[model samples]
Target chain A: MKKDHIRELVVLSGKGGTGKTSISASFAVLAGKAVLTDCDVDAADLHLLLRPEVEQRHAFFSGNEAVIRQQDCTGCGTCLDICRFKAINTTGASYQVDPVACEGCGVCVRFCPASAIDFPKRNCGEWMVSTTRCGPMVHAHLGIAAENSGKLVSTVREQAWCIAVDKRIPLIISDGPPGIGCPVIASMSGVSLALVVTEPTVSGLHDLQRVLALARHFSVPAAVCVNKWDINPGQTERIEAAARSAGAEVTGRIRYDRSVTQAQHQQKAVVELTTAAADDIRLVWKQTAAML
Target chain B: MVAKTHGRAARIAIASGKGGTGKTTVSLNLAAMFGAPVQLADCDVEEPNLNLFLRCEQLTSTPVTMLIPEVDANRCTGCGACGELCQFRGIVSLGTRALVFPELCHGCGGCIRVCPSGAISENPHQIGTISVGQSRTIRLVEGRLEVGVSSVSPVIRAVHQQLRDDMPAILDAPPGTSCPVTATLLGADYVLLVTDPTPFGLHDLKLAVATARTLNLPCGVVINRAGEDQVGLYQYCQAEALPVLLSLPDDRQIAEITSRGDLVAHVLPEYGLMFTELADKLQQEVLKVAGGRA
Candidate 1:
């Protein structure tokens, strides 16, 4: 039993604009018993699809933002010019800080001429452990246009792993952020397997190659599942061959289905829809689960 | 002493504040419409999907390398100077040793900046690769960042090396207005922000437009889902004095075509006309701003 106590996480396609969240939401529903984590902290949308009920909330401090106090000193613009983020600006009378643009480097605060600028640790986002109708979900909402998505993703994944360990669940189905950038790297690292949900497109193949290479770089076993595979069967075949060449397997190929939109409109997974697409996704889930 | 003049290409960038707003779609179509002597650099290296639309045949690839800190155990004195100087807290001293997390290192040479014992040295590591290609009609360049490498700016800078003096280059930027997006739009003449009309879309749009304005780049909006939501996009563009060059309809046919790895311009000839018009408009705008010639 102890040996069977293994934690598993899954990252979808490296390409954005794909239906990664939707497919992962469907899997979350079918898992019957598993902890879900939304690792797409940069543009967290799995919460929209999962509709989690916040059971606990925690403030996340990924980094800091510089705050300039106009009352404290002269309008010396040393901090403004030195700021790599261009986060500080003069508003006629006072110098103000744009929190979103600030990279939180503290260079401005450290070298303020008047010592008026201070680097304040900001609550850039909120991480939550929630309960979904399907299962317990761990997610976070990064402040609007905030940076440090990689850190936010790592925080959410850590919480999800903790929950899975506490519940004695072997699976942690994570809806990772798209792209092979910081957030994607954070989501994919240390995962047992990655199910890359790609389409049959040039960008799809290109991104899949990068993501698969990332998996190999991390020594994680990866599987490919082509979403809307019927849209371009030729490209799908190419992706399949590429996956095989990369020493990975194609777990499933989901066809393009209009009912997917209808199910999403109803805030339901495609597997719950009374359509053939649902059946295909159900099979995809079966294979993905078996791999875990 | 002689003064030298260096000619540079007109670098244009196609970006969106939000994902799924057809940035890559617009970038490829515009590149195709621009005719010859145009280089399409897919700087969305993390997902470089423009190749899907362009169907480019790759030629040369340059690996993007960065300086990662390497600690010489013999020279390291557990001084913790490197750790203390690291603003990112990437370097940590564990008892008699120091650990350098390559992922956290920004390659700023800051760790080496404050290393007292000269234990820290620069180690060149490949973070990504930049590839040049041809899509029959257009020249293509793309950056693919190696996974697990946290930094992508170096790769983007690497992709920037393929620009020719007279060639019109279209930079396909990644979504969001972060460091990566800034890197993509650094030297661009004009930035076309492909956005939709949604709260999240609008929120990020404001951030990106502000960024473009801060950088003193000429910008305009291209609403992807024209009919779906017009009020927010139109209102924002009107308020900001940003021109709306193109508005793509939310047609499922376009989606189906794009999903099939085919460019919309190829499937829908009408979209080609739109791209041509868009390119013309951009040219006129560029001439107006930069003036006919030096």
Candidate 2:
């Protein structure tokens, strides 16, 4: 039995607040029978817009935290001296590692003279499989100041792929985090296509170029859509030209509308609302679908 | 070295959990309004937009490099000690050869120390460039990460290394409560979290506040794009006992100026007073929290 390949379309924005989540939610509405994932685990906002009802939740454990065992008190500063991150703090009688400051490098744990430190896997955060009005969605919340967001993003994505396979869904739409950092890289790999949502500002163009370059570096096909193209028509045109030069197809343009925010306030996708931007987003979905 | 001569200047980091919530805007406007010598470090290496808003006079850039391990094939013992010790999966030993993934390397120098055969040597990988310039009265330091570099904390650390401790320094952190944001928030006396009055803004602001609280840094909230309808953010601030330092209304004129790479204080002089007051309040907050640490 030959199974069809699932189309994983990632909606990414190099600059934050370029309306990636808003457009992603609308795409979920338009793309029927799709598994959606919010790969922005650092500050996952797609779940806020999608209003997913959590059916299954699991704790995500990654990285290790060093704990100084006070009972084995050597009172030696060997661990503190060996530590590179300055995570060790001297208390009244013993030294303790600041978990937040600790990079989990394990230098202190391996070098402790008295074997006083206990390196334990940290419970970073939780990820959930839930159902939304759009479809099944996978999302997560990284612990405050927790490292290894890239791992968490990969976990969410892997689970999204599983859901897509189990349900035999044809599409997976991911709302990727802003920036070309670890999480963004994790969201980009192995995806069928990356839909980069950008605006008309200079920063928008600059970041879009970088993100498109990243997509190209990974050999992932990229498509660009100007979210607020009317803000600066010249920049929008310039961005389209630049994206085309960079080998990315300009999918469509979305007009800037205040009702997009109003739609967010009402916890509904823009396509569900009565706004001009909704029509624009519909056109974007049509073009994006055609490309897929 | 310059920072050391300036005495102990407070390092104030402006951050937001959500993107496009005006972290750079607040940092730039506050830097422009501060009376004392202030250095604004745009630590958002992925997209260093603060340089766009500020006009730099004398700019000098230096490359920031991280050490990635390179295996010496002649020393050919496929002991997977280096791979086992690496937490980031930076290196993997395949039979007789070990492959190194430079992008995943945290540059912790753990592999070089752990290798028994002494097969691993450090290779300098250029991650980004740190530029120092003077914009009007404010000294500017911005980090621009090279394209295709996935890791950002090293570049952010390089930018902070250029900070002068003698004067107040403002760090414009990248959005999201992750390692890059953590690196930017490190060693700051106070953090001013900039956010708007929207659902996404409020949701991520909570995460940013939690990150500050976890780090035990004193933090205040600055509500950007404050409209009449958004009351949830204010209520959350009140409930959490986090002081609302300042609020900038959702003004189209300010947006227009910002879009044109101009500071809000420059276009409207009254906003200058607001930012100056914000700086004063920040100093007070720092003193109250850290007790003369600044």
Candidate 3:
């Protein structure tokens, strides 16, 4: 509970389906006392393995949505004419706004001569605080077609940090979203270490470079773990060389195993199952723990 | 095979709410089945893998640029109209100077219009690149986001601009149901949602389906790596009345080939026939939906 005592480790894969969630869940099982947060708000899968029971839920409101009051006056068609995104539609009698397409730019509201438009806060998604077999977990779901995922990710991390500090947890483990976009940036900001989980393929190598560059850009120290390294050992070696030249340490590698999928089917982390990959994951976790 | 034609070339977008669910695999195979007069655009700028499968000869590369507001310090007054007008928080005034965050800018151009001091001027900032190439008879276009750039929707827009209108186009959307995915789904006539059978896969598929429904776009499902234990995805698709267009079973041979940068349809001719059938079914579905709309 001391200030600046909580060290954070984020598990990320630049390309999706490279075993980011599976690895993070296994790490949670190994690091029993760490507070876990799934920062992949868009397609979070950690809860599937962690089986967190919800303790608190809060609605996330970040953007504006405009609504048209139909009975104000003449259908001047001004809002439709000025809208750039083509978000406004007409039924030949009145004008309406498409909630999904509307960017909430407020241009239509300002240009409406009838003053019949109302801009309301949009309920984009919700974040939750829950307890799991591992520890306290914070996660979220971005509403369908809603924007501002980066903001929601930051909110989830903030809640996770508060829990870590209040409970005096020494570490916070975050499962990050794929791609080097806004959400990834939000997840990487101020994290102690970033453990990038990558596969051994051309696409995997290409994306790992980008994610490493992003981590370096944010000045967050990054480590690499090649998942499914045995699938293509040649590419796996190439990835490790690339990571090394880029100043990232190759913490460990996990072998390809169908039991990884079997574990997912059972809603359990790989380490919890008797699989060959579980031993490999434990090795990766040991190295990752040393870095922390 | 039944020969079919449309009034205009219809666009079919391949998307998955979760990454690594085989969006690129399905898109590449479908494009291969079409053979000629087909264009495939990889809008997953962050990690475009279609080029790895298809042997594309580069034709041209174009940079995608956005107009970001630049504040001129000498334009007199310290009014903060531009700062107050931007909804995205792209520009902010701090005491004496205004800071512009180009990555946060959606390029709405409202700040320049509302700036009272005439200090704001638009500047071009390159965020990514769009490349067009030829892979056999297929026209391939891909967007590659430059490192350090946060937004990718503009690059996707630029790639869509390269679509050849006279031919059918297949767009491979980025993973996740966010702005980048929406940018690719914008004008598509139909969407082929590819997903695996897992709890995570079903969870994100619902989000993708909801997004397509919000745009009023008809969609079908393609189950990748279909296995024995994952019947949840099938049940959900059936209950929703969503047709399962095709299912590719989990085969170790297919996985090995794909891992080596080879297409399953090319290495295994039997899968070619299946993809051709998929293309035909897609054409039929598009026509049926188009006919219903008319």
The segments of candidate 2 whose C-alpha lies over 4 angstroms from its true place after superposition are: A1-5, B1-7, B65-80, B90-104, B107-127, B146-151, B290-294
Model 1 residue A91 distance off true place after TM-score fit, in angstroms: 8.0
- Order of candidate numbers by lDDT, starting with the best: 3, 2, 1
Measured against the true two-chain complex, the DockQ scores of the candidates, in the order shown, are 0.20, 0.55, 0.58
Off by over 4 Å in 3: B1-6, B65-76, B93-101, B116-127, B146-151
Q: State the lDDT of candidate 3 residue by residue for B1-294, as single tens digits.
A: 011245668889999888888888899889998755799999988777788878676668888998898999988266777777677788887757788998787777777777778888999998888888988768899899887576677788788888877889999998888777888898588999998887777877888998888777889999988887464888899898899999998876766677788888988999998898999999999889888877
Task: Score chain A of model 1 by TM-score against the reference chain A.
Answer: 0.94
Report the CAPRI category for model 2: medium
RMSD of each: 5.8, 3.2, 3.2
Stretches of candidate 1 exceeding 4 Å from the true structure = A1-11, A67-102, A105-117, A165-171, A190-192, B1-13, B17-21, B34-39, B49-79, B89-104, B107-149, B154-169, B182-262, B266-268, B280-294
DockQ pick, better of 1 and 3: 3
For model 3, residues A1-292, the per-residue Cα lDDT tens digits are 8758889999999888999999999999999888999999988889999999999999999889888999883699988877767778888878898887778878778768889888999998899999999999999998877774589999999998899989999999999988887789999999999999998877888889989998888899999999988878898999999999988999999998888888888899999998899999999999888988
Q: List the residue pairs that clash in candidate 2.
A: B3-B164, B3-B165, B6-B166, B7-B166
Checking candidate 3 for backbone clashes, the offending pairs are none
The residue-by-residue lDDT of candidate 1 on A1-292, one tens digit each, is: 2424765757577666577877888988888878899887656667766788899999988667778876895887777666545567777868888764566766667667688987778787789999998888999866644564678888888887777777777788998887776677788888888999888876678778888988898898998898888767888899999998998888888888866666655667778788878888888888877777
